[model samples]
Target: MAENNDLASGDDILASYHLPSPKPLWLNAVYARHIVRGNFMALSARPPTVDMGEWVAHQVVEHWRMLVTFIRLVHDKDETGHTICNGRTCPKMSAGPNHSFTWLNSRLEPVEIPAYEYLSLVQRYISTKIDDAAVFPNDPTGVSFAPYPGASSSPSSPPNSGGGSGPDWVGRRSGFPQNFLDVCQKIFRQMFRVYAHLYWSHFEDPLYHLGLEKSVNSCFSHFILTATTLDLLGPADLEPMQALVDLWAANGTFPQDSRAYGYANLRAGERLLALAGATTAV
Candidate 1:
């Protein structure tokens, strides 16, 4: 697969993250601009006129696109002229010894697959969702969004608002279908699995090997902050890489006052111990 033109090379990515002075090559112009300006909070904040679900939907699609581009670099050939990432190298879809993911087929039955295949399926699944007009409307201009049929009337869980009372004006916007939140949740969860696998299984090869670690870290940090800000991903979904998240948060990659930072501080020790135990058992 061809990489996105928006993505920069390893040297550029390194320069961007450790900048002596230049835009971060890790992100596209828009994202780089916000992070460079130190205004990711404002960028992550849902606009008053836009529904939270709608805003998240847009971001999820964008993040998926960019991440796919970034990850393709892993497939580049090594000095042996062999693919760096493939089913032979990663026979199971696992983040580590403790967390192995399975694909849900058309029948909704979980089926284990190789990491390479699982990631491919995810890319195709997200691509299909992005192309589905019913899932993500092409032009939602004049079309008013409605609550999904039989949606709960519980004020505790508003369809568009991901259940929170922010500044009086913030969470009240509405225009997205009630199901958008749930749909985006699934999308992001799958994407997070890909990140977990990358961090656990391929961090050394391709990423550190190509000097793309900082670049990938910067992108993942932005993704974590944005996804958590909108509540697209739950804590359980992030458990596999919670340790890395915590480290980034401690280093100020995420603002201390933000929801993302709070999430990063949540229970990572237990998960790490579990992983260690699993390894020891084997």
Candidate 2:
């Protein structure tokens, strides 16, 4: 229901930007700040004691884990009209027909997984009992070792051994079903578009007829500048942020305009500015 409610407004923004909506769960955070926080954490350098590269890699790994969980949930709901794997079900059970495996296998050519044992192994991996080292052990089973688009092929399928060379990174097989990639891409594109719109509306738009707009826009400009300086976004992503700043500058919608909205915008802007400054200082 919340998804449907968001869909109408989200659609309008997407239309303006020539994009589509991503899957609901992907973007429906209680607040935009949550998404921002996740992005920040994903990109930041890990603690001094930890392997920064591996730590960053974990972010992507975690995302995949969540996606798999979501696919399983949808499948169970479709098959039995009840929630699956919500802590009560048998952990070793196979993911049903609605699983992402169906979509992925259809789009990409089928790759060998160790028969019915694949799901059980995956479940164990998810439980964290095996540890990343054990799960990624040299010559790990049931994994497809493919080079990333820009990576060299010499690594020869993720080193098979785990802790010695780091976690073996498995990629989706080249021949995976087309529909699955389409869905994934569609979801990502929608996420980028909707967040861009929300960012503009809340931080770039003017609020009142007075100098309130100008003040709000000024705060937003400072926030953007600080964010850029901190490297929170790369040059490629900075363009939209700049555009938002320019829009606000031209519109003059500051706190003096609509006190409530302008004030809220200012508060968020201040927080973002602080985050940017802190990041840059580090």
Each model's C-alpha lDDT?
0.60, 0.29
lDDT of 2 at 29: 19
lDDT of 1 at 16: 27
Off by over 4 Å in 2: 1-16, 19-39, 42-44, 65-69, 78-135, 138-282
Q: Estimate each model's TM-score.
A: 0.68, 0.25
Local error of candidate 1 at residue 222 (angstroms)? 0.9
In candidate 1, which residue ranges exceed 4 Å CA deviation?
1-39, 75-82, 143-176, 266-282
lDDT of 1 by residue, 1-282 (tens): 011233444343223223223321222221111223253566676555444445666688778976886567665456887665687888988876678999988899999988878877888888898888766776656333324544332222445444466532212344444466666778888988888788777766666677666666767777887777776776667767655554444344567777666765423322322323321110
Model 2, range 97-154, lDDT digits (tens) per residue? Answer: 1121211244576443422233433444344521444322223343333222333322
Q: Assess candidate 1 and give its TM-score to the true structure.
A: 0.68
State each candidate's clash count: 0, 24
Error (Å) of candidate 2 at residue 222 is: 23
